[model samples]
Target: MKLRCELLLACGLFLALVLIFWSEALPEDRTLFLRDLSAEIIPVRSFWVRSGGFALWNPYSFFGMPYSANPQNQAFYPFNLFYYFFGAERGLVFYIIFHHFLFVFTLYWALREMGFQREGSFLGAIGFSFGGFFCSLSMLVAVLSTLIWFPLIIIFLIRAGKSHWLKPGLGIGLLIALQVFAGEMEIAGISWLLSLFAILFLPEDIRGHLSVRRIFLALGLGIFFGAILSAFQWLITLEFIPLSNRASGFGLVDALLWSIEPFQLKSFVIPNYILPASRLSLSTSAFWGLGFFSEYSYFLSLYSGIIVLLLALFSMGGVRSWKIWFWVLLAGFALAMSMGNTLPVYKFFYFHIPFFNLFRFPSKFLFLFYFALMMLAVYGWQRIQHKPRRIFGFGVLIIGIGLLLYLIFSRLNLEDSSLGAELIAHKFFLRSSLRVLAFFCLGLGLIFLLGSNMRFWLSAGLGVLCFLDLFFAHRYLNPVIKRDFYRGNSYVQEFNNQKRSLVYPPRIASLSAPSEELSFQWLTDPIELYSRLRDGLENYWSTYFGIADLRAYSLFCLSEVSELGKLLAEDSLSPGVRRLALARSGVEYIYYRDYGFVNLSLSYPRALILYQAKIVKDREQIFRIFSDANFPGLRSVLIEAEDKVAGDKNFAPMSDFARVISYENEKVVIDAEARADGWLLLLDSYYPGWRAFVDGKEVRIYRANGFFRAVKIPAGRHRVIFNYFPESFTRGLLISGIGFFLWLFLFGISFKMGKGRK
Candidate 1:
């Protein structure tokens, strides 16, 4: 019977996803076109495939940075084999669907293990997997990928505590490791905290004869094992973070940037009541939220389901088990934390908690809140079986109060009575409130009218209604476009064909257009607006077209490269500085939104040999030299004072030349000749791992021009090769291999012990 229920639940989840995203699932030509999908994920995955299915470096973005080391790329994630097998477009569709299924099914399994009946467990699973917080994450694929494992980790920890078994603890470690590989460390950290809470505070029955010492031991094992298992990725990330722009943790104000506004809580019941009348529209002009529209607009509808909220409230009333109250408290905690700066609790946590300052978007804590609410709702459903009339009364009272409040607010005039937008918002709120009340009435009627003995039919009917409620509210959040939308544009193709570096206009310049004009264009014709946006070749769009971009979007960037980018954007500096910086970075073409790609006629060679170098102890001196209008950046180079190179500053190299013979993602080979000793300069971002070889002999690479690599060269023709081989990756791989073997050994022991017990 349990096996049959599991199979049915799986089928229901698959069918729901198909119905919700039919265009993406059934059609070969349609695909999702949400924010990060195009801006970062698809391009990175495509680049990984283009680099022979595994890449250690990405030469296309930020003037070449570590590809595999960027956790967002998910370089070592096992599930990415789908991309390797089916390509990015189809694989992404499958990846999203699979993770959604995983989320629902894992929640169902966990609830069942906690002794909830199949019907109640199914309700909770549906409520959460289709909840506001989870649905809002559709655009953030990495966050969703990491978040799906939260329930599984909690359940495994519970099992390990109950059984005092090494195998279950090891299993939890593996799940945590998978979450880390999913490429959202912030979500993983959040999941770990929630899992710890579950094992430590869960009600006695749910914990199942737990021992305090044993539970702590299991949690410790899981943490230690998970750390070692994911060392390969995290080790490299730790080494890279200090060098990147996010070296220091975020400040409280920055961390609270996306906190849920207290007024926005109405969304949990009324669904986008704060937005304009056409709340379903994707236009940014329609959003009037606290933060950037793009961030909050995707979650316009935070309504999980009217019935789910009602049942959760019902669970809170009446004499309940400690289990139910525990969920209530947990939900309250999550809600308080999600309020961020609006509440004192979040401020306390920010100052006192470790790793709390590392992540932004305090609203993400809603994931835990929704999960707890779903659990309470499940318990309420079970209780309703015996007291259906009581729950019906409670639902009527709640809906009655909600409708009364809606009537009052709809007629009340705002302080800005003349503002037409406020009137439109009021209209939207009234319309949305009516819809929510109608759904609430129908759900209440379902519980009141259905016969007590007709259990399966009642659960199935309510489940369908809940699914429809969430689907209608949030379906438009993820818009689909033609699969070929990713095909390179004419300008992108032309730049790629030329095999030359391209630089886009500064970010501030791109946004300099008047807000009204941008909104008008977006409303009148979004497709044309998108074309204009793409023409700039911003973000990883250039990477998708196989063109290197000097300006690109990334979560982590080398501090030196970021400093150079700032110089390029400084209007106060001489235009010559911008031109010189672009030329030194080997940019042959510059892209402007108004005018397409313009040729830089005096672009410097990508690889060059210089006989003269200035060793500067202060970084400001290098910047000053770069700022000089007459600085000969191409013929001479600035080296850091600590770097000692075997090159003579007075040795004027006659007819010196260097050119790149081969360039791959991880390795570059250059052929050079000089009449006298010189330094070979490669216009790629200088990082810690790259090793330079002169005629198969090792040579130290020095920081050139603040953010480029240079190696000393002899006075004769020779081949110089630069290879990336970071020690962190090597050490991490060894540690992960050991973790894998230890996990396997523990699994074998557990299996034998189970057989003996049987």
Candidate 2:
């Protein structure tokens, strides 16, 4: 009953902190409304709309990307069934809240064996929950969701030492499946590996009670069955991994792309080194000299809290034993691994490890590093209350050290003079920095008032300190978004109405810039990140208006297509560049709207629709024509003697006067009236999944016009149809269904056999 009360009160406090931390989020104000939202969330939202039907292909993004193959979108995760009902914006908030709860719950459950008091348990849970990784990267829903399952599985692994097969085995398998289903495969993979490590390296005390052979058998089944349970998502990802854009493979340098930089190690002392400008307080400018964008420049802070750090360090101060050394080694390993190419150790792992070769972004391991710090904090607070000198002396030292950082960073010159206002308003950062350190100092100062028996205030003060620090960190950690960020141009409304009146395969393509949302690009540096989805969101808007789009932000940008985009970025490029990019994308009608918020313009691509296709020379000559400034426009498209060029105001150019019969994701029907045996070109992306049929007979679909689908039609008005039937998705689904039931059967048989023996 006491434990339950403590949990309820702790939950209330945690939720309040959540509300305060995310106070900026409001209706229609998308939280983290850029990269993660656009690339991962919105695309999944778009996928959800068509997935109920047989749409394995997304004809909107990047001239039609493979919807099912893009594993990051995470549409297939089970949590979506409940959360998605709230809509994307609200669903994200709910997900963040729910995962925070899970984080606390799992940590508390795992700590039960150590026999910490109620207050100690509560503090450990909150401290771990409020760690810098959680505060900074909570916006990444998949990572947050995937992370909570680690502790939960650890709790189950702790139970794995028991001789009974059902409890530990069922818990491990179910929790592992949940983690895998949470949609961050890389993180989930690490969690499973860690769980296996724990299972194999059972504590000596617990190992004594268990039969080694039985334990091994049960643990093996647990892992194997867990894989089967998540076979649905796993099988599809396995198929996608080799062919993904990363399939070109990651070189050592590429693996270090998001590695924690050497300078960023200062984040251990100075948090918020990578916060977005919007999250900065006015005082941040005074300390601005210390700031730098090493990599993504967001979601990398791992300073749990100053007081928390003091307590964690003190917890290990009294020990020089195996337990402490074990943590030191593990913590050092995580940090070194996060260093990527900066350390030779990571390079060795990249080449020697199988999954390590797949993805980059090494700094993501900070979450694990932060967990290690929390373990020390739990032990420190548990022991430090009895040691008064350590608390008082450590508190004073933290307070005094603020002057050193201030002196070092305050003298630096400004790169951007405009940022000086922040320093001026906040008294050149002196007042704010002292106040931040003072928060920790005050929590520490409260320690002197503690007597030997009054442990409650000491615990309560520390718990409140953790919350205060997290509130301070994340208040700016989360960017405040507004309606203006997403709400743009009346063009979407006009295009929405235009889409209803358009012919079959009503796919829209931008003729000039990738999107009208390019205005947001100027905020990011020579390279854009943490907000690359500005263009992706624009494409999502087109999909929201129920129109298929040609330009979409995709990770799987084909090399040829990526080069085309780069060529178009230069103002010196000809109008032919736009024509070539759009022509191959099956764009019949172009939407060209540009608002002069900046000098940026994407108002040219759609205008190419007016340039009728004419026969030109071969592929080599086409590139030559594009290079020449004096060369002609869309006329360059006519390459071969057999090449046919035709499209109308409505954009469907199946042959010449191709009337639309019907258009669906599964199939498209067109009535063509071609003169002689001219080829009928469908300006949709070419994928092996699509099959072509003419007048009810199967015909071959050829990759034509660089990246589009084209079919040869005999002269007549016979109907031509194209349908999507991706073999990979179908095969994966069948295997997953069989595997799921097979897991059920095996688990039931084992469970019954164990009961009979009992």
Candidate 3:
């Protein structure tokens, strides 16, 4: 009966969510992240997979980043295949909501398996799932997929404490493999780290009951098998990371950029009490001199909702176990980790821990606090025995005191210059306080009447209260898009509408900012989300329209692109020098995406697209032209092997008769008439896995202009083509296949041995 009730409520929750997501298209003002990152990539990925093409080389953004190796790609995850059935664009909401329910069920089952009854486990499910962690990362599909696997891994580990090294160990292995394959390694790493910690600190009584040696051996085997299964993804990622911007290491300043402010920590009591609410984004043009907290860290500010918070606090009263204290200490330490600069403990980890410096945003460690909150909340609920009236009275006393203090604070409209963001903070605090008071009162009434009854209905009401608290918080924290919100934008659809007349695979850019409003305090934090919105729109629109956006946003950028971006942002050169440099670099157009009313108007936006200069193809002589920044004489295209071009007697220098034949995501073809020996240089970012062919025969491809690609063309009208074939992906696939077979063979042998022994 308990099981039936939990399952029914879970389904009801999922169905209610679906009504919001599936009935209509997302709204236009929906975050650029949803449209640009998630929607844009999934469709392209599904197309390639369904067509049996190589799931690599995304040509849409950053001069084509490695699709499968990119952590957020979701190309290799099995569950994504299920979502792809509904079509990538339309099915995204389903995927998100699916994971949410999966998280709830997994947490409930895991706790129940650990000896908690339906009530305790259900409260925990509500605490973790609907408490705003997943909601904050709503568009982060891969991360959520990875996160849901975490509880299942713990469940398996718990089983392994009693079982032999075969079944439960394999189960653990399978879950880890699934998580790593889901794309986000950072989230996966955190889960495994937390898992190891939990196992290391298993309660002494439980350890004694299971025998410590058996627990250790099973866990070790499980992790080993899991590592083997996920070797493909990790192998590719390991190879790529050294070449990425994260290779060298980020500084301490960068690590603390989005760290949580200690003052905002009161959000645990009232989720909406955040000082400068993200929903209240105000433009600097309007409020340039005000104080506010415009920095966007992990949302929810560690809010576990008022009901859960109180329940968790209440559950804390009767526990005297030393093991419990250890967990509580760990929780406090985790919270400290979220305070990047405030605590400086992460700095210790940054310097001491391997690969720790490679990551940014230490505030994400809030996951630890979240885990601990659920654990303690369950403990608190379990302690509330048949004497419900006493606890109910205590709860009312607390609420009454809190409400009285809030009333006094509300009456006092104190303002001071040093009190940064206080005005908005107080207003939000007052509203959230009222909500908490109402809920606390309602909870007291429910406990007084039904807490003693101990019926399933009591648990159901508590679950409903959780739903209401989280849903209300979601209103301001992370809102979803409307049904009509997802239709193609006018700016993006322009290329498709005017397809016939435009240049083939025309390079485009979006100079307009993302139209995000900024608050006064945003000036201190340099995330510059508003300014970077143009980046999201540019990549999304360009990818969908089959256009090359010269300005690419990537995890790792080419040195040349870095230089170019630096030059552009700094405006370092004289006007003549700038134009001359750009002309030689094959720059064609500067585009401005019209983002309706919110767009920032630039004075000289035309300068981005207007480049007209002479093209010279001389493999050996181009260095002289680039030696001087202001040199206007004879602009030459730099080629990788000038000596090779000189050695080729038949090499034809082509400049006057270069024409684009065709361009696709994986292939590019051009027709050029060469009057003399030379190399055809393309000013595009170059990476591994690209092959060049002249007409029917394969030719040598070389790097040119520091970061572009070049090919040797013979002295005639020749057809030259470039194709992408990533060896890493191909090799990784083979390795994964081998690993899969190896695991199967091991499992088979283990099963046979067990049966024979029995």
Measured by TM-score, the strongest candidate is 1
Which window of ten consecutive residues has the lowest lDDT sum in model 2?
602-611
- Candidate 1 positional error at 360, Å: 1.9
Sorted on TM-score, highest at the top, how do the candidates line up? 1, 3, 2
Q: Report the number of clashing residue pairs per model.
A: 0, 9, 14
> lDDT per residue, candidate 3, 1-758, as tens digits?
67667668755765565344323334333332232333355445444544354465665454455566555665567777644576454456566667776777777777765666678787888767777565665555666778888878777777667666567677777887888877766777788778656555554545554545655666677677777777766666666666566667787887777687877676666665322222234432212112223234455335677677767776567645665676687779888888877887888899899978876776677778788777777776766665457566566756755764665566532233344444545555666668677677666656655664564766776677776677666543433333333344565465446654644444444464533432224332212332234324444445544555655454444334455555545455665555454545443444554442122222111101111122336522344445347443222344454343433222222245366666555677777776655566654556776788888788877655544666766667788888876566567667768878877887898789779868
Candidate 3 Cα misplacement greater than 4 A, ranges: 1-54, 199-227, 273-295, 390-427, 444-458, 483-492, 500-504, 512-541, 555-560, 569-572, 575-585, 594-635, 640-656, 695-697, 717-719, 750-758
Candidate 1: tens digits of C-alpha lDDT, residues 1-758: 76667757666865576456434354677666556777677888888877768888888776688887778888888888777777887777777777877787787877776667778787888888776678767778878888988888877766776775577778778887887888888888778887776666554576657766766677677778888899999998888889887788888878887787877777777675332222223443333331121224334346778878867876766788887878888888988988886898888988898877787777778877887888788877776654346466456646745764665566533343464654555555666667678667767766765635666776786687677667656555555567777776675665466655423211111222334433322123333444444565556766776767766648577677668767777777777667766776677766765665777656767788887887877877787776676877756888876755544355443324577778888888898886667788888889988999999999989888777888888788989999997999999999999988988888898888878877
Each candidate structure's TM-score, on Cα atoms with residue i matched to residue i, is 0.88, 0.78, 0.80
Q: The CA-based lDDT of model 3 is what?
A: 0.59
How far residue 684's Cα lies from its native spot in candidate 3, in Å, is 3.0
Residue-level lDDT of model 2, residues 1-758, one tens digit each, is: 56567667766766676566566664455444544564456445645644562245665565565665555555566666534576555566666666776677667666653345666666777776776677655667777777787876765555555555655666667666776767677787777665554444433565466555655555676677677666656665565555455666677777677777787675565455323455444544223323322223445455567767766776676654565556567678888988885787788877787767776667766655776676666666666645366567466646645644564576533445665544542443344445457665666665554633467878787787777665655555545455344433465555455556655435555544544334323123211332333433344555544556555545554444554455556676667665554444445556555431111222222211212344444644544454454433332233333444444232323224356677655567777776555555665666666888989999876554444555667766678888876665567567667767776776688688768978
In model 1, residue pairs whose N, Cα or C atoms come closer than 3 Å (at least 3 residues apart or on different chains), thus clashing, are: none
Model 1 / residue 37 / CA error / Å: 1.2
